[model samples]
Target: MSGFLEGARCSECMDWGEKRNTIASIAAGILFFTGWWIIIDAAVIYPNMEEFNHSYHACGVIATIAFLMINAVSNGQVRGDSYSEGCLGQTGARIWLFIGFMLAFGSLIASMWILFGGYVAKEKPIVYPGIAVFFQNAFIFFGGLVFKFGRTEDLWQ
Candidate 1:
């Protein structure tokens, strides 16, 4: 028995959970910055091009606000726990989270709409602006997900 149980688990042993969180967080940060770089590149690459629409940038703003809101609420509140019940309550917190997701997804959908309806429909079919907006929203969404769920085994967890 002594030989079999010679040693117990050690504090120096690798913590897989922490490792996963660190990797996911770093990847999410890279994606976030890459997306921003795409947006900036589009604006700078063809500065003299008058075909680019100025209003497309608004989608980024909307997504940013949603990102902020999503991060503002505590995870406990989102899960509808007792602690979160004190401030906004379970229902309120859920509602707030819902609104945040809607805004985030809406930004994504809006980018597509602008691409198809505004550009494609008009037969101009510009690639830079449309793709930039879509990538921005997508990366933000992915980054938010990674930030929010990286610590957990799964999203719902």
Candidate 2:
């Protein structure tokens, strides 16, 4: 009975482990898509400078770039296990990852600044644009994080 129960438990764990990568990928993709979708909706609904400034889209663009940067380096490259030929090797990967994180954070902060400074602080605040900007950055940032750290690197092998 003990062995049977242990075997069942191990199988269950293995099943979940096998599915983890798919689950994480789906979640990250959903978050990224939803973020872009929200921004698109906001832009279409308020296509005028008076309602939504085109400048605000820059934050989402930066965040998208950051997302790509963050995911470009694999865990092994960052950890010095599978990469060691570049000018800086693992150190370079680490630095690139750091810069990516900085960009992500910077974009997110900029979005919040836009939200409060451009909309919330105004006398007659129009909030949808600001909220949309903030959520877009937030979702993209989180999605990048999920894609970067939520999966098992071993699964790729």
Candidate 3:
């Protein structure tokens, strides 16, 4: 416990410690959106796709978010090395994951809102395509900016 590494308990790791862990975190982020798009395109849109043009943009948004989550988590720790990264090690990862949540649950909630709004508003379907794309892309673009800059942070180094 006299040396720096000694005082540095696994709990002390600010995410993945800018080591091998970041790589794993990055992988998870990539997989997340990969799964996201597959689910969205195959499961959701594939079944109820009335708006491909809109859905396509939405898919891009999902992909962008997925990219950010992977990097964000990577900022904290590697996939298998999460234990050392500390509680907030996954902060970047989780933030990205939240964006992914927006991509997924956001749509569901919007649908519900639209359904309710349909009764009140003149629109019947209430499902808007642009909205989904807007959120997804916005998240991705912003997330990407952070990831791009944060890549050189000391936490990961």
Can you tell me which runs of candidate 3 are displaced by over 4 Å?
1-6, 9-16, 20-39, 42-124, 153-157
Writing each residue's lDDT as its tens digit, candidate 2 over 2-41 gives: 9999999999999999999899999999999999999999
Model 2 stretches with alpha carbons more than 4 Å out: 1-4, 83-88
* Model 1, span 41-157: residue lDDT tens: 887775644566777888888887887777677777677654436566877878888999899889889988877776678787466677777888789878777766665534345
lDDT of each: 0.74, 0.93, 0.47
| Stretches of candidate 1 exceeding 4 Å from the true structure | 1-14, 82-86, 153-157
TM-score for each predicted model, relative to the true structure: 0.77, 0.93, 0.34
On residues 44-105, what C-alpha lDDT tens digit does candidate 3 reach at each position?
Answer: 55344453333354445445545545444543354335447655555655665667556544
- Give the clashing residue pairs of candidate 1, or none: none
Reference-based lDDT, residue 41, model 3: 48
Worst 10 residues of 2 by lDDT: 79-88
Better of 1 and 3 by lDDT: 1
* Global lDDT of model 3: 0.47
Taking all chains together, the TM-score of candidate 3 against the true structure is 0.34
* Residue 105 Cα positional deviation in candidate 3, in Å, after optimal superposition: 23
